[model samples]
Target: MKKTRIAALAAVLAFAGATLPASAQTALSENQILQSLQSAARVAPPNLSAALIANAVQEHIKNNPGMPITWTPLQLLDGLAQINVQIQFALNSDIIRPESYATIGSIADALHHPILAGYKFVVTGNTDTTGDRMKNLELSQRRANAVMNALVTVFNVDPARLEAVGLGQENLQDVQNPTDPINRRVQLINVGKYLPGK
Candidate 1:
């Protein structure tokens, strides 16, 4: 029985040797490795290993090029600090249209979740050139503030976690059209110190 256990441990070590990151593989102590394995045993289900999850994350990145994903859960054992969120608006309106409630709810849920709870957001409002530039600027600022209020009051995001600002028609999405629907949007860029954990 002891021999079989040693053999299994050896096999696990060899498997780790083949796939573990250089940082982890080199510095991870025997106890740490065993603990990691034990944790893995509890969390990983049948047909799924830590390596398989790593592979899926890699494949997801390879399959979807130009995305901002760089790390996986295996790498993010250390907690994250903050995250970004973007929301869009109609022309000259501060109200989050009823149709976009679901998306807004998802953002709230993400903000409330354990992974992204600590993050702060800058809710930037943008607009198309369908109206006067100065008016668009003022309107955009109002829209941005409205969004901030909705997120804080309606969605229950921490007021400290949000900042609302307006860019007006400055950063046009479809520069060629100058007033495209795609331009009328908000992008929640991860501002301070958070990367998307896969």
Candidate 2:
């Protein structure tokens, strides 16, 4: 199952003309991130509601706790323009590690690119299945919040354009091996356009 997911993700990235890094630690350049995002946005669903998506994830976590999520809701996002990058945090804490600042900065640059200015994004935090499920969920949310806050306050991104959600181990990238570090990641998803007049 994990291999299948990985192959599928690779295929999607390839089709989009994006290259997947060998590991999460490899830094993606601003142009690479920008191009990947732009490609994804071109085919993304129109007018997705970040609030609704956040609420659904929260509801699922509250109801299912540690259970692996089914594909129904996740499938909706599978076709969206999204990229998962590793963001290092302090052990059992939400503090952003200094080494990951470059990656975050690159993401901000991509978000600020002219082509992406009108799009809204979801910043989702995920964790490997190595700790308490509920606690992991909370920690993931805090980490996601931290990243979003940095983008808004430090990088001058519009707060209204981003939403943060934590899925913990519910949607493990490597379902067969829940403890894989690849499961621990921050996903930036281009949800839809941000129209103030709506």
Candidate 3:
């Protein structure tokens, strides 16, 4: 099952990269990957698949707190799952609802941990499939930027270490039912390597 999930994730990332402009595909950096993923999130369902794979990776990490450093991107993602925070925003708007303050606080706390020093991350926003695709994508991007701003302004996280991207409804958590609430979520993808004792 782990192998299958890993393969699925690799395939999904590959397909996502293939969809980007040729100029953007030459050398894929973390920023490029984030950009490609965001673009794919706007027009394809692969983000949903990526999220599912990430969720599984997170679960694995949760089950084994002593996960080794010699792991794949999926495993590294699972191992560094602190970025999988859930924050709620106002309906159709980038404004975060009051009820989500706790989650935001937790994210702030996690990022402040000593172990995460020097780490760089990208904040990603995803949406359910309910409106115009382009609009949804734009909203997702705005929400992501909002989260990034909140973390930097409110939590004192270094702005240089963060980037925000929105993946619109291109990756619905429940494709068969695009309106599923689970589809709306915020995820943080690390741009730096995980150095356990750093």
lDDT score for candidate 1 against the true structure: 0.47
Sorted on TM-score, highest at the top, how do the candidates line up?
2, 3, 1
Each model's TM-score? 0.51, 0.76, 0.55
Model 2, span 19-110: residue lDDT tens: 33325333344445565665653465566655666666667667664455442235446657777777789998899998676667667766
Residue 5 Cα positional deviation in candidate 1, in Å, after optimal superposition:
46
Per-model tally of clashing residue pairs: 3, 0, 0
Could you say which candidate leads in TM-score?
A: 2
- Give the 10-residue window scoring lowest on summed lDDT in candidate 1: 76-85
Question: After superposition, which runs of candidate 2 have C-alpha atoms over 4 Å from their true positions?
Answer: 1-31, 41-47, 58-73
Residues 95-198 of candidate 1 have per-residue lDDT tens digits of 77765655555445555655456444556566766777557767777876887787688878877666666656654444555555555665342223222351
Per-residue lDDT of model 3, residues 71-149, tens digit only? 2223323333222334678878899987665555545555565555546566878776667756877898899889889
Candidate 3: give the clashing pairs.
none
Point to the candidate with the largest lDDT. 2
RMSD of each: 19.5, 7.5, 17.2
TM-score of 2: 0.76
